[model samples]
Target: MSPLVQPRLINGPYDDPGLILDFRHARRAILFDLGDNHALSARELTRVSHVFVSHAHMDHFGGFDRLLRLSLHRDGPLSLSGPPGFIERVEHRIRSYTWNLLDERSADCVLAVAEFDGTALIRAARFPARRAFAREDATPPDLRPGLVHDEAALFIASAALDHGIPSLAFRLQERMRVNVHRDGLAALGLPVGPWLNVAKAAVREGAADDTPIVIGEASIPLGRIREHALAVGPGQSVAYVVDALGSPANEAAILDLARNADQIFIEAAFLDEDRDIAAARRHLTAGQAGRLARRAGVRRMTPLHHSPRYLDRPDALRLEAEAAFGSEP
Candidate 1:
């Protein structure tokens, strides 16, 4: 069956961390971090309508200018969600640039920025790219614990982690997974088109089975299509975590937010031998990352964000993590 979201690491374990989640059958995409994303092509960058930032740390947020530059002419508003001070930081970034030249042209870009204090949205702002990126306080929706952003296809959840400051670990979960039966469609001589996407949306939105589906000149019942042409199941979920300390509170929060996630992309900034250093620096050791994954009951785990000191022996970190997860490396 086709997965609802395809997740790919934007950079390697030792490089700055970032993840791009591409919706399987849509033009939209979600960006987990803004870190050194130079590797992503312009087309891929343009597809990112929502960017979820862990924090404003330089390594995790340095790519914001590049994203802003590439998406300036995109059709829709770009939304940025992050931990506290996010709105002010976004405004500051925009204020650093002069937009006098943009006054003559039509405004085409709008930015929606939201700041989260833990799981609550404390502030929000919006601005048009052509208006010098001016800030306008916007009324945000009623706060929901752990929910960062909600959409028809999926929703994002986050937990505050300690990195000497508030760094967020995120999860992206699809509402449901709907698989179209290609063989059945071929057997019925029905050509697949945008209607299939509509059907998937209808299921996610909990539409009645008797809902009508338009195909060519005929209207068909969704129940008939389900009986002959579709398979439905639980959707995909992926959690991203990095630069967090291995404290009890942080561990508990991470475990709760990432429980039973299909895959977890977590930081392993140090080997077990450097546990003290890792603790002092507010980062996780490989063993700690694996332990968290095991405790969280994640189906799969990838350890990332290795320290530059381990450049010559990066495999050691993975080995340590594997051992801690009760798997031989």
Candidate 2:
């Protein structure tokens, strides 16, 4: 099945840690972080409906001001999720500016801030940064671990991790695997028609009603339509993580989500030579990021969030990380 979660690193090691996940097919697109979002213009920025932030660090959240300015008048609600104090920080940013210019504008923005408390293992979302919605204090409520989004073609799961402070990792999954049942269609003397689209939707929705399926004047009971006959296997899963340290407690959480991730995006803010510095700063070195990716059994590792000092020889840092993880340069 074709991958539904399209990930593009707008900025990071190559730029600055901005990712645009196009779940266009699912009718929703998500932006991971908001560092240097030069890759996304005003028009492109409005395309995203949700923004998941790892932290409030400057490099991680500097682009939010511009994003807010662009999305202030959009039709849809712009949900923003992040660590604790995120709402206050965002409110402060907004209050810092005078709304006299924006009062005339239709600010249809409904910002939702989700904060994770590691000690409680719970996540809470605050609407308008004041009103609290649902709260989960149990095992870190599975934010769509299974059929979370339930859109026609996509499902998304969000998991929290410790990045010095509270942080989160999101996994976007395509719910259905689409495949042509050539043999079944041929056996039934049924030429592939647009009705197959309805059947695929039925399979995804797990619809039980035996609605009559019209195929060129022949009405066939939908119950007679077998799923495996026209269905494929599982779809793809994409996981994104950033600004996290390699700690035993967080390691398991990170690995569980990243294991088998087709493309893993992680932060590597320091080099192996600066391991001590990385540890002190509660950040991950390139080598550590690579090793964790290998340990997690990720297929592809894109180490990003490099410190500015390595700007001159970024390739050197990348190679060092790959070598440490036993990956081909």
Q: Alpha carbon lDDT of residue 326, candidate 2?
A: 77
What digit string (tens of lDDT, one per residue) describes model 1 on residues 260-284? 9999999999988898999999999
Q: Model 2 off-target regions past 4 Å? A: 12-14, 24-28, 100-107, 118-152, 179-198, 205-231
* Model 2, residue 132: C-alpha shift (Å): 19
Listed in order, each prediction's TM-score against the native is 0.92, 0.78
TM value for model 1: 0.92
lDDT score, candidate 1, position 252: 93
lDDT for position 91 in model 2: 68
Name the runs in model 1 displaced over 4 angstroms. 186-198, 211-219
* Number of the top TM-score candidate: 1
